[model samples]
Target chain A: MNDSQQNIKKNVLEKIRHGDVVMRPKIYFTLQVIVVAVVAVCAFIASVLVVSFAFFSLHESGELLLLGFGVRGLLTFIALFPWVTLLIAVGLVVLLEWLIRYFKFSYRQPILKVFFVAVCVVCVGGLLITFTPLHTNLSDTADRGDLPFIGQLYEDVHMPHEDKGEFRGVVVSVATSTITITHNDHDADADDGTRVVTVPTNFNTSILHIGDRVYVAGDMTNGTVTAYGLSKF
Target chain B: MSDSHPPYPTDEELVTRVQHGDQEIFGELMDRYTEKLSRYGRQFLARPEHIEDLVQDVFIKAYQNIQSVDTSRKFSSWIYRIAHNAFVNALRAQQTAPISYFDFDTFTAHPVYEDGHAERKEAEEMRVLVEKGIKKLDQKYREVVMLYYFENMDYQQIADILHVPIGTVGIRLSRAKALLKKELPVDTTHI
Candidate 1:
């Protein structure tokens, strides 16, 4: 070996022999792997739950039906979109990606590929979870005031957005050109929860029935809603 | 013509022994990797005087972190990874090139592929050009060239050491060659 090579080898071995440098215990690395794995799993679960809840909220709020109501409905859907939930989901996915990047399988692929794969997996998992009763049970818990901190998310889901010219309730009475609806079962006792909706001349009430859940888009002046768009969910 | 000595232990075997508390065996690893890492450091740091200290630091880190090495994988990759980090940190301290926080090359997919025969031929032809124009290339491109042509590492090994995608290694090498062509004296396109 050359003089320089000998010097490097001797200096390093001397450091090791003299205890200036020492190998970390096996448990240290083991714990590091375990912690990364746990955090990754936690972030993934949080991402899936947050994404699924966002979709569920949009559907239960009758906002999903707004997409079919034309431009105004589309605008309301965008305005009421759960941006916070979406941001949280994105953050969780990024955290998950950062955690998994240290692994061989993930590092072998392009970051975009890994990020795309993670997003797809989380979105699919979220959609699949929507089919389950998880959110339904959670919503019910929130309604009862038993849920901590997140109860507000489910509180106003069934309420009408008067400011946005959007209303959701159950049809209580139907006439030739008008329909009377009451706030969803949650506020049945509130005397002011009912409204009279005036439909267009060509509007069809043949598809309408009492007690059907419906969405109405119109201007509400006083206790009556001048309806321009209406649909039954 | 009988062989007098038994076959030497592989780097993986030696590392496994080191992990199992064979501290002295690290000296053997140091002896094996010092020259190789010095060459890597010299090419990467652009300062031959600093290579010995940098190589020594790499050995110290490798020895201290011996328990973290996975015996199933290549020990060369692990050591080279340490060396790469050390050299990059030194270069960063020197502010030689702007290595951004995010590398877009790794952020997206590239269409480049590694063909063994073609890569060997291209590397041979580009070696002289790379030696002449390497200092002008960016840090990100220069390191891949050093690892590929100078260290003789394959795309996957370079990816492991650099913690980048294999396709990234290919893209960087291709881009490095393009840059070298522009910076070199001859018309490299004919090669």
Candidate 2:
């Protein structure tokens, strides 16, 4: 060995002998693996729950019906979409993918491949979760005002987006020029849920029943909605 | 490399000993990797100063992290991974260029078709010409060429060391080779 190489060996050996540098214990690595695994599982579950909740929100609010109302309805749906929740889910998926990349089989593939698989897993898992009574039970708990801080998320699910010209409720009565519906504005069962909506002459009021749920799109004047588009839900 | 009839304990065997508290056996690892890391540092840093210390730091870090090594895998790959990080850190400290957090090339999949013997021969033929033009290539591309040609690491080993997809190793080497062809066209006729 050359002078510098020999000196490096000597110095490193001396440091080791003097206990200046010590190998980390096996438990340290074991704990790291456990921590990583727990965090990854938590991230995955959080991602799935958030995605399912988003779907539940769109379905319960009748905002999803806006997609059929035309371009303006589509725009309003886009504007009212729960993007913040989805963004959080996306961030979690990315974090999960990063953690998964530590594995040999996963790291051998490209990041995009692994990420695409992760997104699919989350979406499918989320869809499956929605099929369960999870969100339904949670929503029911929220309606009873028995839920905690997360109850507020479900409160808006049944509320109308009147500013965006969207209203959803059960039909209470039908008239030649107007229809009266009972909507859950603040309370689902309050008497104030009743509202008057004026429809165009060409609108087929004959298709409406007294107890049918409906979605109406129009401008709100005072407390009444002037209907431009209507669909039965 | 031929484990069928070996004259000495393999790097993995040495690692097992070190993990069992034989720290002196780590010197064997340092001996095996020192010249290799020195050559790597010289080519990677493209600078003479502090190369010895940088290599020494790699050994020190490896020694400290030895317990984390999986004895089932190639110890050479593990140590080379450390060397790669140390050299990259040194390169970064020089403020040579901005290293991006995300690289599009590694994010996507590419086809990897490796003919080990043919590629090794080709790399050997192109080594002299490539060394002359490697500095002109981008940092990402330069490192791949150095590992594949000079260090004699295969695509999988290089991928393990760099923590990129194996296909990414192929992509970078292909791109690096193309850049070399453009830079040293006269000397690369045989390659």
DockQ of every candidate structure: 0.82, 0.78
- Can you write out model 1's per-residue Cα lDDT over A1-233, one digit (the tens) per residue? 79978998888888889999988888889999999999999999999999998888888887788788778778877887889889999999999999999899999899989999999999999999999999888888876778888877777666678788888788999998999988753532353478899975588987789999888888899879988788887
Query: Interface RMSD of candidate 1?
Result: 1.1
Error of 1 at A37 (Å): 1.0
- Looking at candidate 2, what is the lDDT of residue A211? 94
Per-residue lDDT of candidate 2, residues A70-100 (tens digit): 7888988899899998999999999998887
lDDT, residue B173, model 2: 91
Query: lDDT per residue, candidate 1, B1-191, as tens digits?
Result: 99999998999999998988889988888878887898888878756677888889988888878889989989999999999999988887777567686898998888768887888887778888888888899878988998889888899899999999988999999899888887776665456
What are the chain A TM-scores of the candidates, in order?
A: 0.91, 0.91
Residue B33, candidate 1: Cα error in Å is 1.5
Note the Cα lDDT for every prediction shown: 0.86, 0.85
Q: Which has the greatest TM-score?
A: 2
Error of 2 at B32 (Å): 0.2
Clashing pairs in 1: none
